[model samples]
Target chain A: MDVLKFITCGSVDDGKSTLIGRLLWDSEAVSLDIREAIERQRKHNGQETVELALLTDGLRAEREQGITIDVAYKYFTTKKRKFIIADAPGHIQYTRNMITAASNADVAIVLIDARFGVVEQTVRHTLLASLLNLTQIVVAVNKMDLVGYEEAIFEQIKTKYLVLTNRLKLPKVTFIPMSAKNGDNVVTSSENIIWYKGETLLNYLETIPIIPPQTAESRFQVQYVIRPQGSDYRGYAGRIQSGVYRKGDKILVLPSDLPSEIVKIEENLQEVETAIAGQSVVLHLKDNIDISRGDSIVVQGATVEVGSQLQAYLCWFDEKQALTNGARLLLQNGSNTVKVIVQSIDYQLDISTLEKIEVEKATLNAIVKVRLRTAQPIVFDTYNTNRQTGSFVLVHPNNHHTVAAGMIVLNENE
Target chain B: MKINNKSFDYLDALEAEAIYILREVAGQFERPALLFSGGKDSILLVHLALKAFRPGKFPFPLVHIDTGHNFEEVLAFRDYLANTIGEKLIVRKVEDSIQKHRLQDPKGRFPSRNALQTYTLLDTIEEFEFDACIGGARRDEEKARAKERIFSVRDAFGQWNPKAQRPELWHILNGRLDKGENMRVFPISNWTELDVWNYIRRENIMIPSIYRAHLRECVRLESGQLLAVTPHIRLEPTDEIVQLPVRFRTVGDATCTAAVESSATTLEAIIEEVIQARVSERGMTRLDDKLSETAMEDRKKNGYF
Candidate 1:
């Protein structure tokens, strides 16, 4: 079985947690002990039935507040596939948490309350999903039971969501109307909604084809140099960011642009003739070219933009620190961490409006386009082409907190 | 390495991600150490570490914070595995820390050294100035751990502030930390209990004999949980011990790690049991976590792994 990572996001009280709880309950992922604990909590809280949302609220503060504060990862497996659910908080203040969850998710489950139809939070989530390049979007119109299982409400919400998704240019989207609290159309088809005939949420997740972006450029950044003691062996160790590398393949070392031929590829200490993307391997070069960590090894003739100045989209994460022009920070991409200075702030994104707003500085949870100049030239591809090579994080030099996440954006003229 | 198949196996994917995290631990930190507990999870970490850095000696040494109240079988296996790998192993005892600090031992029938293990762990980190401590913690084990970042940063005192955790984006781990602070890296944070067992079966990795079913003298609790009658636990007058075929789902301090009756002598059987088992590994086996609602969260805040 393969793994599929997905995120569930919505406004507060849209039942994102309840929806995940229902899925786990129906899938038998909820253990007996946890079920008992939730039942006990239900009685303590003077509730008639067990509160399924209590399952994901792991922290004491969250349990007391009855809200999810941070992203909680839940895992379950069926015969078809293994699923990783990032149950992110829905509060507007926790948008950074939602962005963190979306960074690695294959699909985005944007929950829309049936009673409220399509809200601003719904539009914001869908827009962020589009920005993160999540091709598959599942618009879960939840709380159908509260709305008397009305077909008109579901249709209206679906239409409203489609308009926003189209505006964002989202390629693939599936709308499912369900009641998370009543266990309708979540793991099983809902009988209350006879007008709906789509597959259950679980079914879609199990059968969804995880199509990874196709890239021809082979890129590998050396994370560490493996030179065992008392041995004449030398190997460049790292995971292949994209494409494949075969023995005897001519490769160019980044920055220095030194030429080398792959003499051997060692995966799990065993010699292999080829290595594909995502596989960690040790590459033995024919010649010692003064290579070390933070150096990239790319297939010769592969188009990789190498430069000191780069234009990218930045998502500010620090609550106290704001992003301004001429701010010096550490840009860490792949295995390389270089000193970088923000040259200019092009525009800040209005998440709800989906419009670019002119700004001098971007605050917390702000997404902005900016230009940066690195201390040294680094090799990268557009984030659209290669997510692994193009994505980076900016770290504060003194406090060492991750300040922002960046995605490289290349101009057509460049 | 050759792409003969279009689809990727979940185990292969988990393994690749784990190896990548291990490499990042080696690449990012100035002094890193792998925390080995002799449990299946940490054993799996050792296996992944070999896959990660084999031609070269592991960039870091294996460190184990021994809570003296540990199973002899596990301790023996820990040493054996470390020796076989031909890597340096550093063992620090909680007993030593307790004695040096004149700390009070937990008073109970099954006095757990779980909480005290953190003191020794933090002391070890300070002693070695290890910037990163790679562990085998999985998010599926507990609630608090579910929200934990892969590259979790801790303060000088080794306290984990869940609310202030740095946002980990994509695979780019932010291992940058100030002096006196360290990172607690969980490479297998995504692997579930069943996934670990399945991977072990697929790789045919050797685990300690305690993992397989064996007849052991255990005191049956009123809650139907079986506590191994180890020397660490204070046997009561009314306690009844019986020999039963039992296996440890998770290897922890002898006093707090409960056993479950099972007849699964093979890895396949263990995997099958894990798939069908209703209770989670922690819910079923970890007696320490049953003490309170936020037991894991509390322990993490006080620097316990």
Candidate 2:
């Protein structure tokens, strides 16, 4: 079966953890020992019921503060597919944590309180999800029992959320109203909500089609060269970022722009005639060429931008350091790491208002568009076209911390 | 051209991601070591390492922090595998660390060396100046590990500060480190217990015999958990000793690791048992984690891997 990675984000008290706990409990994913452990904890704390949120709050500080401090991953499997949940924090101060969770997710589950409708947190989460290009958006209207399981309340929240989704230009969205605490319309249909006719949250997740973006052009970056002992055997090893490769196909080495033919492909030490995206393999060319790590290999004549200067949208992650113009950092894309300088800050995105504001410097959790100049030419595609090859990370040279995450943006007139 | 249109298997995707991360560890660090224990998780790491750098020798050596309270079966398997692979194996004994530091042994029936193993691991790191250490830690095993980054950065003292972890975005990993700080990389961070078993069955990888069901003398505790009757344990008068078919779900220090009553002689039966299991791996097999709610988090903060 395939895998589906989704994230849950909402305000501090929207019961994102409770929803996930209920899903695991109902699906038989919670073990008996874990259940008994939680039971003991409940009596110690003198709580009326077992707090499902305790399952996700693994850190001591988080438990003491009664809030999720960082993203916690939870896994469960159904007959149809395996699901990976990225349980992100809801507090506004941990926006960077939410971005880290959303970066690799295929779906974004934005939880909203039925009573409060679409709040600022909901808007911000939806905007961030859209910016990350999540394939689908799931708007779960939680705490419906507090609103008396009224369909009108669900409709009102759905309407408000749709306005934000439309403004953000999100393509696919599904709305579900449920009380996570009561298990209403979550894993199974609820008797109280007979008026609503739709698949439950679990069913929707299992059945949603995951269609990867289609690209015919192949791109591969050589991470390590496997040249065994003192023999004539030499191979280029890396993962295919996109497209496919077949034996005897004409390929070109990037930056050097040398041409060769794919004589052999080896996967897991076995020779294969073809390899596709998401598969790690080694390729042997018909003719020996000068190639090393940080080199890109693609089908001959494939269009890939090779330049030293490029524009990208960056999100600052460092709280102690501020990103300023002309700040030198290392930009790592695929297997290649090049020295880069932040040429200029074009604008900063106001997440709540979706407006571009001019900024001279970016601090923690600030999203901005900037221009960067690399010391050497790098091969890449625009972020919208190919996510694997287009995204990069900026690491501070002095402190050795990842300060920003950037997505390459191609100029229209380039 | 015949295009293989079959959708990618989840196992294949996981393996590919793991291999990619392994290659990154080799490419990024100057001196890296694969932290190998005799457990199935680390065994899987070794298997993946072979697939990652086969024709070319491994870029790093395999290092094991021997707790000295380990099962002989597992230690033998560890040596046999290392010898078969023909790679360098470095073993550091926790016994030596305790003696050198003049640490007091715990006063209990089961004197656990679980916490003491950290000193040896840190000493080994300092001795070799390893810039990176690859482990088999999976996020699904515990909650604290779920929040950890793929390339987790530790301070000079080998402490993990959860709040200060860097943001890991996409497949791009940042292995940048200062002179004293080092990184702990987990290539199989996404694989769950069942995924590991499924991959083992698919690949037909051989594991230690203790993972399979065998007759063993176990002392039944009040909590209905089974502890193997080893020399390290001081048996109580009330403890009931019984010989039953059992197997270890996890391999840890003999003083702390527990066993379960099972008859899974083959990998298929083991996979089925894992699917129908009602307890988490650590919940059923580990005694150290039961001490506190945040036991794993606390240990990780203090340099326990």
Candidate 3:
């Protein structure tokens, strides 16, 4: 069985958590003890429908307030698949939490209330999911019973949602109309909606083909230089982010463009002929090139963009301060962090309408475009090509806190 | 050996993710140590770390906070594994902090040194100045641990502000630590209890024998919990000791950890039992969690890993 990491995003009172609860209950993922605990909390909260949100609301503050704040991860396995749901709060810090949840997610479950007919949060979450590079979108139009289980309403919302996905360039879109509160079209398709000819939410999720991302040229970012005591071995250790490398392949070290041939590839002390993406291995080059930590190596003919200037889209995560021009921060990409300055603040994105508003400063939760200058030339690919090489985090130099996240935009000239 | 371009199943993907995190800890942090308790999770972590960096020796050493009331079998197994692997092992006892006035042992019934182990851990970290401590804490263990970040940052006093954690993205782990602050990295944060058992079954690793069922004298607590009779736990007058076939779900301190009546003896039996078990692994084993609703969260805030 494969694992699917999906996130449920919607505004408050949109049945996001209840749908998750129904899935767990129907799948028997929620055991007797956990169910009893949830029942107790629901009674304490003085609620009716066994407040399934209590299961994911793990914090004391969030539980007491009956609200979810940070991102909470829930794992469940049906017979066919294992699922990891990144359930997050809807209203406040929505973009930040969605980024945290959707960063490594394979799909996004955008819950829309049928009565509301595609609210603002639906658009914002879908856009954020698109921006995070999640290609699969499951638009679960929940609360169908409120609108009398009408298929027309579901079609209207899906049409409008498709218009938004078209703008966001998300190709894979799925729509299922269901009343999450009544278990209609969730795990079992509702008989009331006879016109809808789609699989149930769980069935679709279980059977959907997880299209594998295409592999690009091999990009190995050296995380640590492993040199044991008394033994002279300069092993550049890291997980290969993309493609594959075979022994004796000619590779070029970044920044300096130093050329070297791979003399050996070792995985767990045993020399192997080849190394693929996601396997942590140590590589020994033939020549003693000037290789250090934070340096990346690529196959000889692979094209890697090496520059100091970057056109990037960044999200401000710091509530204490805002991002300003000439703001000095550390730009961390892969395992490397270098001093970087904000060259210019470009424009702010109005998430709801997908419109650009030119702005000079970015506040907390502000997604803006900016140009940055690193102290040293860094190697990167476009974010669309390879996420590992193209993504970076902005760290505060004074406190060493991660303040923002950025995705490098590919310039047409490059 | 095979250059396969493909996705992964549940366990293989989890193993790769954990290995990647272990590599990051070695790459970014200075003076890091793998916090080993000889428990199953820690043992699995050690095995994964072995696979991560083996040709060039593991960059970090293994450190254990000896809670002084561990099972003899577990301690012996711990030493054997460390010696067999030829890795450096550091043992910091809770008695050291008790003598140093930093910690005090409990005297009442259901006395738990679980909370006191934090002081010893912090002291050991300060003594060695370890910038990162790799733990085997999984998110599926408890509610509070569920929301914990993979690379959880602790303050100068080792307090975890769960509300103010740095958002981790992709495979890029940020390991920047200021002076006096450290990180508790959980490589297996994404794995569940069932996943751990499945991996253990597949890998066929050697663990402590205490996990297998055996006839042992146990006391039935007033709260319907079973307590293993150890030298540290003072038996009460009303306590009823009976020889029952039981096995330990988790390997913690002898006094605080509880055992459940079981007949499962082999690794296959344990995996089947785990699949059928209702409560979580810690729900029946850990005595510290039943003290309060937010006991794990409270302890985490006070620098307990």
Candidate 4:
């Protein structure tokens, strides 16, 4: 099965790390030393019982401050599938971290404290998850034991979360009521929740019939040109970011309009007949015209567009200052990067209501539509069609920091 | 033409991801080198590098920091593999750094030169001006490594500010750094010890013979730690030397890397043993890691790869 990557996020003190620790523990993924260390640290922290959160709070500063200061990636596996969990802090100021985690996640597990149901942080994380196009959302209503294991509280939170998910246009949402601290409804069936008739959190994760990715146009951006010593091989090696390519398929080199056919495809140094999304392979064309890093290959008859100006929706990441009009930055589109100017900030979306609010500057976590003009014409597609081609990140030209993540709405001249 | 839509096994997926990361490093960095240790992880990395850009020679070179206490078999295997692959292998000895008065060697009965290798590594990087140094550090091995980015950026002096990492999202690895700064890339950051073993078994990759069980002279310490009786080892009067069959979990500094009593010589037995083991690979072997709670974390901040 394909590996599932997801993020577990919630407001602080909502047991995000505890949930992760419990999952790893029940799955038997934690090593003996780490588990023993967790026990020792818990005792030192004055807790009579083992504090599961200590297992994930890796950095010393995080443990001392009792908060997750940065995003940490954790992995676990069950018999059915392999999983990569991105544990990001739930604080509102760490919106950039949440965005980073959500970008690659196939699903988002947004935890809601049973006592504090559907708060502001919950809405922000869900909206950001939606913005990142996470296919599935699982709202784990935690601390059910603290709430007396009542079904009514779970229903109330579920009702509120349903309203929020509807506003965000989230396609799939699953609500599971469980006590992460007590391991109820986490790995095994819970007897306390007699009214709940759904699978446990782990079971649900294992059996969710992973929504297949959309069939995008075949797009392979040339990452490196490999010319072997004392050999006749001139291969363009890169990952097939989207769609699929087969041997003998006609391809058009974008931005150059050069025609070619994939004479051969090599996977891990062996010739292969086909390559799909997410696999890196080297391709040899029948006749190499001109190619290097930053050039892309699309199906010959595919309608891949090229434009110098684009209308984009971007999440401002830089905390130093707000994103304003006429700002200069380098736009990194896959392996290609070019200088770009922020032409105008059209409007910022008020996340809570999903309404358009007029804003001249994009503050942190503000999702705004803006116009951008690049130095050169770049090949791209709508983000809805192909994420690799449609997305670009703005890097601060002066300091080389990524300032914002922009998704092309469409080419301006489309 | 039909495109193959087969899903990869866990190990295959990991290998593909590692290769993908190596390609990105090749495309981004002006000068890059693989930080090759004679350990199993580095052996796996060297094999992956061969597959990553094969049919063609690797664009980057392999670098090894000789701690001067490495196992003779491991060093010999490192050279043999480098020669077999026909790649440039650069060796920088920590003894050279000590001779140049750049670093101070510890003077103790049972001293490990593992920590001092960092100075030689930094000096080598500065001398070569390598913008990216790929290593075989896995996240599952340590807590601090779990929080690091795949493309971990370091300052000009090679300090790791755990808090100030670039937001690496999806496939866009922001490897943008200035002149003096460099990025430490870990292609197999997600692989576990068992995964590495499985890959080694499946790929039939060659590794040092010490990883297999062998009879060696060992001394039992008061703390229940077993020390191999190498020529460099300082023996205490009360310590008793015994011949036992053991295998090394990790092959690092000879003084610090302890061996576990096991007769599992084949790769399959090793994998089975790893699957049934309780302690982590490093926790069971690396004495340097047991000194403090954050020894790896602290060393990493000082440019230890």
Best by lDDT: 2
lDDT of 2 by residue, B22-106 (tens): 9999889999999999889999999999999989899999999998889999999999999999999999999899898987777
Candidate 2 CAPRI-style tier = medium
Task: Return the clash pairs for model 4, or none.
Answer: none
- Per-candidate Cα lDDT values, in order, are 0.89, 0.90, 0.85, 0.86
Give the range of the ten consecutive residues with the poorest summed lDDT in model 3 chain B: B1-10
Off by over 4 Å in 4: A411-414, B1-7
RMSD of 4: 1.9
Flag regions of model 1 displaced more than 4 Å: A213-216, A412-414, B1-7
Q: What is the TM-score of each candidate against the true structure?
A: 0.98, 0.98, 0.96, 0.97
What C-alpha lDDT does candidate 1 achieve relative to the native structure? 0.89
What lDDT tens digits, residue by residue, belong to model 1 across residues A1-414?
678999999999999889999989889889999999999988888988678887788899898898999999999877788899999898888888998999999999999988888888887788777777777999899999998999998888878787887898888689999999988999989999999988999999999988653345799999989888899999988988888889999999998999999999987788887778878889999998899899999889999999998999988988998989999999999899999999999999899998999999999989999999999999888887888888999999999999999999985333
Between candidates 1 and 3, the one scoring higher on lDDT is 1
Instruction: Residues A174-281, candidate 3: write the lDDT tens digits.
Output: 899998777888888798888998899999889887644326779898877877778887889888888888999999999889999999998756788887776777
Q: How would you encode candidate 2's per-residue C-alpha lDDT over A1-414 as one tens digit per residue?
A: 889999999999999999999898888788888899889988998998788887888888998999999999899999999999999999987888898899889888899989899998898888888877785988899999999899999998888888888888788689988988888888989888988898899999998887553354799999899988987889999999889899999999999899999999999999988888888999999988999889999998898999989999898988898999999999999789999999899999998889999999999989999999999999988887888888899999889888888888886343
Model 2 is docked with a DockQ of 0.79
Model 4 per-residue lDDT at A201 = 91
Weakest lDDT window of 10 consecutive positions for candidate 3 chain A = A208-217
Off by over 4 Å in 3: A42-48, A412-414, B1-8, B102-104
lDDT of 4 by residue, B133-245 (tens): 99999888888988999999999878899988888866787788977888999999988888899899999998999999999889876657677988767888888888899
Q: Candidate 2 chain A: worst 10 consecutive residues by lDDT?
A: A208-217
Write candidate 3's Cα lDDT for B1-305 as tens digits. Answer: 23544335667778878888888898788799999999999999999988887656788899999989898999999999999999999999998889897455788866778888889999989999999999999998888988899999999888999888989887778888888889999999999888888888888888898889999999998767788888888887888988899999899998888899999998888889888988888877888887778889999999999
DockQ of 4: 0.67
Error of 1 at A366 (Å): 0.8
